[model samples]
Target: MKLPHPIQYQGSKRNLASQILQYFPLDIETLIEPFAGSAAISVAAAYNNYANKFIINDLNKPLLNLLELIIEHPNKISNNYEKIWNKQHINSVEHYFEIREKFNKSKDSSLFLYLMARCAKGAVRYNKSGEFNQSPDKRRKGTIPERMKKNIMGVSSLLKGKVKFKSEDYRLLINDISEKDLLYMDPPYQGVCSNRDSRYYSGIDHSEFVVFLEELNNKNISYIISYDGRLGDKKYGEPMPKHLNLEHIEINAGRSSQATLLGKKDITYESLYLSKALQKRIINDNQNTLIMKELKYA
Candidate 1:
């Protein structure tokens, strides 16, 4: 099924969502995303009925607000987006910069959506002063208003009453997690765009993230993390510690766009880490499946 993704975000797991979600248990009360970039996984889960409820949280307040508007007031956002998008046809480059400046000052959700739609490579980069600074994609205009409306409304219909939005630190959000909740994390890549990763408001400390994972394990929480991977021979970020007792799975994320542009063939493999608790649940579920097959054959 084609999932509705109104916002085009860099490092979104939209393409890899189905592969990641195959590991999800049959029943999930809530799916919590602490670093919900575009909320790709949550949207996919909702469309596929993998989770009954979702908590989409991000430290980026403007992005979170944009998502809220997309889900709550699709028509309002779509209409505002059409006005902004239509004006860009007269002078795409200049119009984009004007929208970006206004968004930086007002932090308006509608302006944020237009910026995200037209930004280069769908990458979100912020200045040190916390302003949207990514340049617009010059090759073409963003998604058409008609298609954008379709995506926005499609997403709203699926997630209208099923999602809760949060704009807080992940640590604070994780403190209230219960066993029934399945947390899916897609934190910013550690070494991407310099050591500090200007793409995010702040980069996560590698050591500190490891400690956070340890705490989740200690609590016996079920979780899945999409962290660190290899691009051909080069690897990005440090692998999860073995002491965490997590199961590591490599997902083929297809070719590297950068490599392809450079006339090289490099396949990207993203790392997917499953908590021991979730792994055990999968095993039991698999065992039951085999038993059911045996009973049917008998």
Candidate 2:
């Protein structure tokens, strides 16, 4: 029997992978994922027994650092998680703070796993000093999976030199793609996290994302761009070229409270709208960079 494919993300789009896979041809030579948050796409493609022509990139340093540990020293990190997971903690804010302090002092994947597992609501937050500031999950007790160490070790074994991970600003990744390359770009949500300072996704400017999309369009690279339709401002609007195809996808984001630390039990589901806009630009005379679209999100 074939080995069962592992879903390597805390909140992965494995369910949507099948639909997204439709955008990709089976015989494609390369997969270009510029914003590989949590490596959902990379892990999914690798699990499907694809070739090693996957190039994944992200700007976040800590997240990539953890993945490096998972790739290089999975056993030690898994052992670290098992050791940390076995300990019991009292339901006190003070105990949470103590663990948080320790997590900040260490930079290994073991501490990363422990913090992610035990942190309140599993939000990875850091202070200006780059310290792990998320509190402990006091409401629920953690149940460490049996043989979790081995399972994590299995993540590295599964990857096995088939995936190439990169840490860089996605805007600079256009050079990495060519014609016929399948690029699945999952950038940070435009506005939902902007209004609240509690969100960990910082420094992602929506305007920059629009520019990035334009670059990809100019290069004639095949790609599927995912973004939020519920813009923070109702005044927001976008104009996709009449030539490129446009499509909408609606998926419930679900109750926010159940999905986050503040657990207000919000029923709002985040609907992801994917678009493929490619249009012919009419150039009369002088031309610099042909701008096809300006992203206007709510």
Q: Which stretches of candidate 2 lie over 4 Å from their true place?
A: 1-15, 89-96, 127-130, 141-147, 192-197, 229-246, 252-298
User: Which residue runs does candidate 1 get wrong by more than 4 Å?
Assistant: 192-195
Clashes of each: 0, 10
By TM-score, the best candidate is: 1
Q: List the residue pairs that clash in candidate 1.
A: none
Top candidate by lDDT:
1
TM-score to native of every candidate shown: 0.95, 0.71
The RMSD of every model to the true structure, in order and in angstroms, is 1.6, 9.8
Put down candidate 1 lDDT per residue, 199-273, tens digits, no spaces. Answer: 786667777788888888888889999989999999987888899998999999999889999999999999999
Of candidate 2, the 10-residue stretch with the lowest lDDT total is: 277-286
lDDT of each: 0.90, 0.57
